[model samples]
Target: MSNFAESRADLESYISARVPLISIRSIEQDRALRLVREMAANPRRGNLPLWIYTRATGTRDLRTNAPTSDDRSWPGAMDFAATQFANRPQSTVVFVDPDDLSDDNSASRHVAELARLADANAGSIILITDNPLWSGLQRLGMSITLSLPDASEMYDVIHAFLTDHRGVVPIEWNEQDARRAAEFLVGVPEGTAINVLATIVTKGSVQRDDVEHLARFKDKHFGDLAGLERVEVAPDSQQVGGMTSLRAWLDRKHQLMKSDLRGTKLRPPRGVLLVGVPGCGKSLSAKAIAGQWRLPLYRLDLAAMLGQYVGQSEGRLREALDAADRIAPCVLWIDEIEKGLAGQNDSTGVGRRLVGQFLYWLQESRSRVFVVATSNDVRSLPPELLRKGRFDELFFVDLPDSDDRQEIIQLYYQRYVQREPTAELLDKLVGLSDGFAGSDIESALHDVGAELHLNAGAELRPEFVVEAFANTMPLSRTNPEQIDEIRTWGRERAVPAGRPPTSTMSGPQHAGRRVVVLSD
Candidate 1:
């Protein structure tokens, strides 16, 4: 059954049993109301009238916004609801996101009184809110959380929408396209999905490409990222030099991310923890994943989340994670994760709490927020956070080897100089940049490119590039011990991000004697 249909059935039973209070938790208020209205119209309930209350429209019929009560205030609505529940039986009143119910406040007390009347008269009071009610109030009744639609439900929603506007605007999307668009809009609400589809139609035509454009439309809804910063992933930014294993793993995850796994027991790959040498492509890998997948990139600044007041840091972190949940199918980059997760023994205990909270979210959240947490100081991180199930994989991004260096050299060479490097120069540069990191190569090439750009009359020569590389000193040279320590831990524990070191033959291989087929 569809999520909404299942929810409707559950709600129908609650009302049929005369449950005093029903709390429907969801951000999709309109969708929840529709479910309630469907339950009210159920044959078993005898199509009971709905006493829907909103702040703007005090008490009204669910079907129409026509006010059933003249006073459009909270106290007035409460009194009206109480009177109906006390006098009339089998009455259902729905309050749409009423405030001050979070505590034992006046509004909550009023709701409690209404609940008592509801129970005595065989009526029910429905609370539609995004947040959970106070334990005292919530304990009086049942509550069900309606999460965002999954792939199958999203497909039906999209199909229905497209059917509604079949000829209104030019729609080139086929069934397959609609299904693919539904996968992208999995975490989005039905109304938002339709609005996005309408937006595409507003452009005069809905091409097949509109399916991929759904992510961008979904991104527009979440502009205010409280604790996260949007990192722009340029097309060229995906030019990661090394980490072949990590990239291949991410590619597989990307396929799963785009696939329709609606009713499956399987879930999309969680994320990877990249720990290795500094100045390598660890941080850049995060951007590469975002760029490659064409998903929005958000950087979680742990430092910025720190606050002077107690619990403030944790609150901010929660808000950020909640925001991430809302904006799913996106990459969340946490650079230098060790720094944020460190200081577990601090007096304030905030760091420990933050670590626990982050790990909990990482494990429990079903949102498709692919985390790419990079840590140069992996040893400083808590051992619990490094558990096998915490991350999909812990990759050790060691310094690039000969082949990786060559690829890195060529990548930045073409990017900066706007031309491919010569074979002889590439060989020489690769041999020269034995211990250089990917960033080191890029920086060297950038200088060479700058010189070529500024000195327009100067020709692009291997000498200029070689000179720039020769003058560069990498992190491996400056901080050899730190690099060695990271590498040592990586070799023992994590998977290598780069291709395994290949062994070369001491001499040329002996040629095998040719064999002719005996039977023709």
Candidate 2:
């Protein structure tokens, strides 16, 4: 007897009396059958019957252990039901192969014929298939849904099936482990789920993320871009630095997703688009976020995805997205997105369609894969991406403010220097490095250190370091106009990565953020 109940006494009572139809989808046949039995009372004198859609040829029926043969199509399924009822006079059950219900003309004919017989015989019908061809039959009758089993219920459902069918899965499935397994399998395709379950039973164990459990992506990488601290960082990651707003947002989102099985049935925003000058912490942020989440990081290199073959690039992109989804709770970092997607076009709307496909997946995907993409230029980014739900936020990383410069200098000095430097000397270094990109400061330091080492027989010296600074020409001077333009863009559009303390900074327009410059 099926222990699971499908509905309340009232609903079950109603379904048992009438020729009720139920539609169940996904890898839960046992649960679906249990639902049917619960909704059914004692078999009717002339009409009580059941039908199942399966592709497996019955070499031996499980309950009877009788050798059964001859695959039956959907229409034949009705005949089988009628025949069984005529002989047994109890509830006659017929199994129909879902593969029989294709969209081909023959398939439609079979479905129509089955509907006719079902109406005439006063028999009950249940369509259990994934996006089945008989979905159109819904228009004829009010179809009730058998909701997908929740994570908590999946183990019980699977165990029930195995006890009677698979002869595997231990009887006592721990609640915690079962919950984890259910969560891990959520959103996986049906074929993969079955294979995984079968492997676990037959082989004694199956490691997660194996080729047998491959989600859908192949191996690939996008090009590595230089610099992360650019003012125009990722759109969603922009207006950052405070961490207050973003932290709260992330916590909430994480809770919502976890309640649905760690994003197995939930989603956040699409991906990110980082735009700005080089040398900020944009790349660092990408890595840091993944580290914080304890998720694997995959870098997608577009250049590697590109190929001489037509559609190769698009294919690689699709593969990468699938892989990310399968290995979800992971991060896919696409550095310098504009360089690859900016100019590519195809006659059949390949590029456009690819972008649309990506957006569509982003909109509908329930996987936990988080995408972090960076770009140096935003002028040509498709407008569709700027839509509200695309990403969480946008950030612009400009030159380090004095306070940030001090922090950066301190970080590097402590990293490279054996002992702490004098505070007075550090302040002077921070001042002279003003208006300079983080990388420029590094370059300046490197040049000075190199000269000092060379002149003093590679021995570190304070005077030599001072002399190198005097001789070095900061990129700030050579690229003044460009820097200003970037800073202008950073304006209010960007957030501070290293905001000055309230006591040290003023209320200037650009006081807390990376600067933005006018195009002219």
Candidate 3:
């Protein structure tokens, strides 16, 4: 059913044909054996069955060459090899030592032995090795590289291995359960993951519960993203909101990264940057994007990532990215896009180089991981991150106007009401909370609850909420030019998140209402 299996099946059909050599790679050797058998029995009429001239370099004597440690015995391999060789005496045979091939004497001796075998067998010969063997294989002219396990085939091989060799009870231990668990914890430590899985499934019967346990395991049991990833400047985007256009752009990126995609129709977006005001919803939007896309999120913390020690930060970042890729289809949320890697040209070249490496991986990668980067300042970003194809689109989440304000307020009020909020009151609160960002609205809502608690008679009503809202200073006013500069920078180069408008501002300020913004 998988691409690898389908591909391997096709490859099997060519095993005995004019194909120079065939290579089957997988950690699941049992399933690989099954594939060899099926390939050897291709049903094509008037066509010869597949024949593999597998030859070994180890001692050929039955007693001396016998394997000592594992069931993958030389005897077993020899038996299999003999069976095939007997069936096709003139089949091509390739032999390369698994050990050192650098010593000219050893190399020449091995090559001579393979040549003798090929002559006696009346078949072509090839060599496989790391360095010296490369020359040997090349001298032979016809050879194939042993490819690593493919993802699609990997699960099947593993499941088959579990069933065949590990006393797997198919009814008790199904392939679906094993595959699902493996997919869920792909990056978990091998030992820990196995133990956790054993504990879950053995909870004794149906595989459904085991799957749920994997789903609910918290950050502590599983590896922590904060501990695993790096960060950079692109001011965080969680606070940003009302970016309908931006969300749409990311949605397209999601489709591009779908697992079902294949063969060139699937081109994922390179990356995306969030341009927004200081206290706007840019950071919040990035976090919400994870929820929207139904993906795991890894926040890259540059401050936590960079180390005073040489080469450490970069090494850590590489490991982090590897982890992300191994757990593909996750969201990488990088906060404070500007400051995170802006100093690359000067004293921070090492840090800049690290960002360069990240960008490099970003460009060449073909996985489903989505990158959501938020920034308050754009001038600090490297030219590379801003390069034409780097991101799908650059969205600017400016300050909230009337409609957005209403959404923010309605969200907070509905959250507090523990039910739906009154529509009229929602509109009034939205107007009273003009200029207040999502964060500011949340703060004001909290303040209103505090105000209600401080006074026994007054319930936390819209009027009191407006009073609470009026008491706080919006971040735009609190930090004057800081937020404005951000907005100005994004004027045209960036797409707007859509404004809620200022005419709503013409109405009288709410009675006893005060606007406020929280400060660091």
Candidate 4:
């Protein structure tokens, strides 16, 4: 059976059993009310009259669509509901936006009394709201949360929307694109999905390239949520300098990562945890993965999710996760993950709870939100976070080796100097940049470019770069003890990002070698 069918069945069973109070938490009021009408019309349900009460529409008959009374205020509505149940037993009264009961003490008492009266009179009072309010009703009623449309329902929604606008606007999606769009629309409401589709096709025909438009639309949907920021990804052709091993891993999973995965046992890759020394391209890898895979990137700020009120933090976390799920097939990057989650020993235990929630979602979330978390201090991280299943792999991004340094130097040289480096210049810069992080290499090269620019278009020379390197102090030299600790941890626990260092020209013998000034 479909998910909605199963939920409707559950609702029918509850109403048939004459559950005095039924609380449904949902934002889709029309769909929720439709389910109530269907349940009321069930042949076995004895034709129970359906009465819906809203602030604007006081009381209306579901079948006839006619207003029964004009007492629209909260207190007035409660009194009217009590009168309806007492006058006619076994009627279903749905109170829309019943959260107002929590704000008024008299209304709360009135609802509680009405629930008790309905229980005795064989009638039901259903409370419908998006949030779970009125804790006082917990003892008197049962609540069922109606989730947003699932994949199958969303697919139907999209298909129906397309069919409705078939000739009005040009549509160019095949079955596969429709299925992919449905997956992207999983966490979004059906109404919003329709609106987004309408907005997209409103401009012109929606071709395959318009799939990116849907991603941008989903990003807007998540913009209002706290603790999550959407990051724009560069094109897939943008190359990341090093981390050969990590890049190779991504290449292997590239096919499955892009596939829809309908009939295969191959699950999409979860993501990786990059823990390493500072300025070693850990966070850069996170952004690069999104570009490499052609997916959007969103950064989750865990510390920003903490709220002053109880449950608010968890709610915000859930909102962020849901937003990620909605924008699936995207990269979720959490930089410096340890700083956000290392407070497990706090007095209030909020940290512990947050850790539990995050770990649970990390393991159980089926959405294709590939998480790439970077951490500089794994020592502060909880032990459970390092377990194998939390991430597909844990990589150690140490300082760049000789070959990686060469590639990084060349990349930045072309970027900053707008000219290619000669063989001798590349080799000398690589030698001098030994034990330097990727950022350190870029800094020195950037300084060289700035100095050259100041010299009024002077010809680029290797000496300028060498001088810049001499003036710079790499992180390895400044914090030797911490770097040593990180390298030691990585040696045992994590896989190296680049291949092991070779003995050709990376040693100290070449460190001080002066570049030969070859005349061009």
> lDDT by residue for model 3 over 243-314, one digit each (tens)?
656666666766665434435565655567887776677777767766655456678776577778888888
Prediction 1 global C-alpha lDDT: 0.86
Top candidate by lDDT: 1
Residues 1-520 of candidate 2 have per-residue lDDT tens digits of 1122343243355445544343445345655555555444344422443334455543223233354346544445555655544454334343433544535566555555554455555544555555554555555444444444433455554544445543343444444444445555544433345556665567554333332222222111212222111122233332223223334545565454334444354454445555566766566567656555544567777556666677776777777676566545456677876655554344555556556766787777766666777766655556665566766556566667777677666655543443455787777787777776666655666675555545665666565555555566655678778767766775555543344336535465554676899796
194-301 per-residue lDDT for model 4 (tens digits): 888888887877788776567767777766555678777665325778888888988887666667786666677788999998998888887888887667788999
Q: Which stretches of candidate 1 lie over 4 Å from their true place?
A: 1-3, 23-27, 47-87, 94-115, 127-147, 167-176, 186-188, 343-348, 503-520
Worst 10 residues of 2 by lDDT: 220-229
User: What 10-residue stretch in candidate 1 is worst by lDDT?
Assistant: 40-49
| Cα lDDT of model 1 by residue, 1-520, tens digit | 7778788878977887888999999999989988887776666656675789988778897766688868988878888888888788778889898985887777787788789888998889999999778877888899878878876788888889889888888889888888878767876788888888888878888898777677787677777788999888888898898778877888788888776666787776789999988889898999988888878899999988899998999999999999888777789999998878886567889889999999999988877888999998887898899999999999999889998898899899889899998899999999889999888998999999899989998888788788888999998899888788889999999999998766678768887899988986
C-alpha positional error of residue 157 in candidate 4 after TM-score superposition, expressed in Å: 1.4
Report lDDT (CA) for all predictions: 0.86, 0.53, 0.57, 0.82
TM-score of 3: 0.62
Error of 1 at 387 (Å): 2.5
Clashes of each: 0, 34, 40, 0
Against the true structure, candidate 1 reaches a TM-score of 0.86
The predicted structure with the larger TM-score, 2 or 4, is 4
